[model samples]
Target: MPGEITRFVLKISLILAVFGASAPVLAEDMLVIAHRGASGERPEHTLAAYELAIDQGADYVEPDLVVTKDLVLVARHENELSDTTDVGSREEFADRRRSKTIDGRLVSGWFAEDFTLAELRTLRAKERLPGIRPANTRYDGLYQVPTFAEIVQLVRAKEAETGRTIGLYPELKHPTFLLQDAGIDSVDLLVTALREAGLDGADAAVFVQCFEVGPLRRLDRLVDVKLVQLVNTNDGPADEPAMRYGDMVSPSGLAEIADYADAVGVNMNLLFGPEGIPSGLASDAQEAGLAVHAWTLRKENAYLPPVLRRGTAENGTGDVLGMVTILEAQGIDGVFTDDPGLVVSALAQ
Candidate 1:
């Protein structure tokens, strides 16, 4: 029996060696992160959007979080609620519609911070880009603004039901604005929620992302889960100037980022040239031992580069699969897409 077992082990080892030497370098499995839940099909940040994303085989679901007056953390792309909700039409919030300088931009709107969780709950979500995504507008007024806790619960339930591990990617939107304007510690609230969900450990399938270095640095000290520093292609927001995102992709900038963040989520433009080919940014981040995840892959021709656009309409279809294929070839660790199914299918190819 011992002699027979030894012969079998040798045979398997020989086969592996033969195949391994001839095989091309295998690529890491590219992750498909549903940007704001399958946001292309539903009102972004709503539970319906998230659920659709999960159904489409997303590995992670992203929620851009903002704070409410009662200090509840809720899913919102920005604190300004006018564009993404039905606040403007509601006479009850008419008096609440006032402009204030937030993060250096003077804006007038019914802000989320002015409403308690219950008040915010009474409102319904709308399509943020109705003109560009008329189909998604069909889902408007169908879902409520989900709280961070509720989002966590939904993801947990999905995981248990589907028997598949899905990650949570929550961005702390405008941390400085929240801290200065409302005296709210957004990171603390996020960390508390993550801990309560039993997802604050180092190995937990959670990524806390922020655009500012200061907030990311603070979060690194508070949470054991992975932290991602988001970089905009343009110079930092006008009201809040910091290091340019271009600089952040530089060797030294990435090195500094590696000190606090396990990964970098950059504007997709940084990974491509005007001719639509791979650039050095992904390789540089990998060299610095930081995982790279690119953002905002939409099907609209307007959102895509000139080289990849398929039509002239603002809402016209583009070669999303072609762009995704190029990005995958660049060896990115993950991608953020409004259409999670497209990315999943492209990656499978």
Candidate 2:
């Protein structure tokens, strides 16, 4: 009788410990999206970024895809090559350098549209913000610009090894600009590549994101996989002059989006309300039952919510704990951040 009692006590103790450990993680649904794959710790969109994010316990690693002239999909923030590479320094390809408008803004850089995938492969990927993060300069020309295919390979390996679903979230960057102007559309090409990698449709654990309504909606029509709509401070497409963010934040707009999309990816500033803090929800967003995923979080000062800024310094002072807490309270489904490890650790703590 005594031994049985002791064993029962130990079993009870173990159950209590597990419940305690799981309590914090169960408080809310917190999806850690490696914003451009742990970008705060590595050069964004490289294999190093994706690997580190997975290693750090990110639920999803986001890769933004743009097409090259040869129709190969490559991971990039935009079609432009200036900020993320040493392309500007190579005068041999100077003629390839030209200015173009993307989403109504005239950007001066070497666009991916100007280069074949083979030609782009010759250039190495580098830290996008060398000015703010000169330390990243040490790795300026080491890694290749990874393709969407490579990221799928990494995720496939993890899923096979662990039997846990590690997902890939690829944003179709500048879809309207790429489709109409560059003559390359992501709907067909990306879906096909994902299918090749065995990550197509809902069963594949791949979620596609896009800022323009038409592209994400178009993708929805093409595939059964989940679609995420990205909203920003920028203006809507020329055809949709009637719809803008100031108005989109209205109840009517969010509901319309909820009809087509599984989730809404909003700028952190707007969702959290510019205070460097997360506001619970805009009445409109909550009513729509649209899952909210906030974006572009970094450990940098420039991206920090205003409420968290302490000094006169222009950059981040590494104060992210309060913001995470606020996000938890706001009931966010997922967050896009350059430091997924930091976010995961904060939630765990």
Candidate 3:
């Protein structure tokens, strides 16, 4: 009970520090997306982490979607299970381990594609970054890998409970690999799932994001929901090997992307220059009629620039408030973060 009280006090203090009030409400214009839920605090892609993000006032919860052997969609950063699950320790499934080339890279592990949803349910979730987020390991082995359908149900329930219209940001992980290499039609699976959930329309509070260009273009025709084209700093989309991501963020590239995608979800580095000056990429994309959302704003020192890091410890929280402030000043529409409450706090200030 004393520990509980301490936690409650900390929570309220955090809220008050940013919002200057007891309630944790967010502004509607600038979006706070929970990258794999509050992954900084809990295991990524678990229902527990997602619920925590929603409770912390995240507008959207991101679930990187991968398919099971039964063709059901589940939330995982990648199809590989060993990193985020206890599949490696499960003696019963030891034989299931094998190597396969996914998206042109050879990966060896227990894959979601090899397991039916029932088989996956038998495994438990663990912190993917146990080295950096040691505290999150207390939650390790406590959650099951959640289905996208289950996530939708959780969101709908939360919306009703909170009276806030929460949004779903689902990324199709390795769509090209699922299609060409694994022989699964992920686009159809996703479209069918969203349609069944009544979230396939333009008015739906959802964004279908992908790193590949071809799938987003295909989705644009099939679904009315907004599409986000994810761009990396150095690498291009796997499906479009010859096309550089650098070109995609250019004026011409932004124009081309605006043709199909509603927004560009770019790596956070693209938004800032050497001394954290605003790069014109956000404004440039917006000028091309695209909303700009940035990927992966984390509080940890490991993920932050050396200037922003708070301590020598890699796991220590950094100047995320300052990072979000910079991105907000650049006028980006939304931010993806592992620590949603921190971002919410930053934006609320």
Candidate 4:
């Protein structure tokens, strides 16, 4: 840990040397959160991915949580498993496949809730987007779908090994659908797990996030740990249609959100308008006394803005440092990235 502390101190000094004394605060406060644990390099939501992210200097690792039939919390981008697991190839679990409507869209797949943790252990994690991240497909059958508790254990072990305090950013996926349609209370399960792990205290390095308002509002009443309201550019929270996401970034909307949320995790595009002018979202949300974190800074050309992209190949790397620089200038509190190593490098520059 002493080495890590020394590295951090050097990093701070380097920031000041390169960008001036005023730059230290922004460099230190802005967090580089691993979106699904350096997902650009490994199958997302697996222990290997999370560990890689931590080793690459990420301040936090994010896990999108879904439940099993036994109500155990596990990390997956969605409740459906076919895209990210070998469940579809397993003959024993073939009958488990079916169609269900989540958030008004009908999706057919092998769902996690249909199997117990033991049943899920037999399936191996795989790249969710093989067409875009074909390199990650090589490790397809190597890792297991990790549980929320298991992830906490991994973080603790890594902290002991690295001597650095790593944070957990867990997002309760489809909270409204999971509770109302699937008949599972993910919030209680998450809180109970955090409580058992001694991570529910106000000082704990945890931020509970949700895309729906009801769950975040409920969590605000249930836990002292920070809560984040995730907003995308296109739509509103599924539970609150009248509350448009576009409007949520407005001064009036941000004021309303500040009542229940400590931070707003928004789409990165929201921070900029047409012609790349500052959209004022970061400033507006901060003005409402709310921290603003931007989502998904990836190196792939497909994910980068046109000006920063290198070529037509969607899978090729782009100028991610330029993207990070733009967001940093907006005074964003944090950034979610698929490549923690790249973001860490960008911030160091």
Using TM-score, rank the candidates from best to worst.
4, 3, 1, 2
- The digit string of per-residue lDDT tens for model 3 on 24-83 reads 223247899999999999999999999999999999999999999999999999999999
lDDT value for model 1? 0.85
| Runs off by more than 4 Å, candidate 1 | 1-27, 237-242
Root-mean-square deviation per candidate: 9.2, 8.9, 7.7, 6.3
> For candidate 2, lDDT tens digit of each residue in 1-349?
3344345334434553655522112227589899888888788999888888988989999998988888888899888987887788887899887778777779987988788878888888899887766766788898887878778888878778777878889988777777788778777898788677766667767778887777777777777788887887667644355778656666788888888888888887676433222233433576697778888667766667555554656554555655566566556788888888888887886
Q: Which ten residues in a row have the lowest lDDT in candidate 4?
A: 19-28
Q: How big is the positional error of residue 346 in model 1, measured in Å on the Cα after superposition?
A: 1.4
lDDT of every predicted structure (CA atoms): 0.85, 0.75, 0.88, 0.88
Pairs clashing within candidate 1: none
TM-score, every prediction:
0.90, 0.87, 0.91, 0.92
Model 3 misplaced stretches (Cα beyond 4 Å): 1-28
Residue-level lDDT of model 4, residues 66-129, one tens digit each, is 9999999999999999999999999999899999998878999999888999999999999998
lDDT of 1 by residue, 198-268 (tens): 99999999998988888888888988899998988776733238557788889998998999999999899
Off by over 4 Å in 4: 1-28
Model 3, residue 168: distance off in Å is 0.1
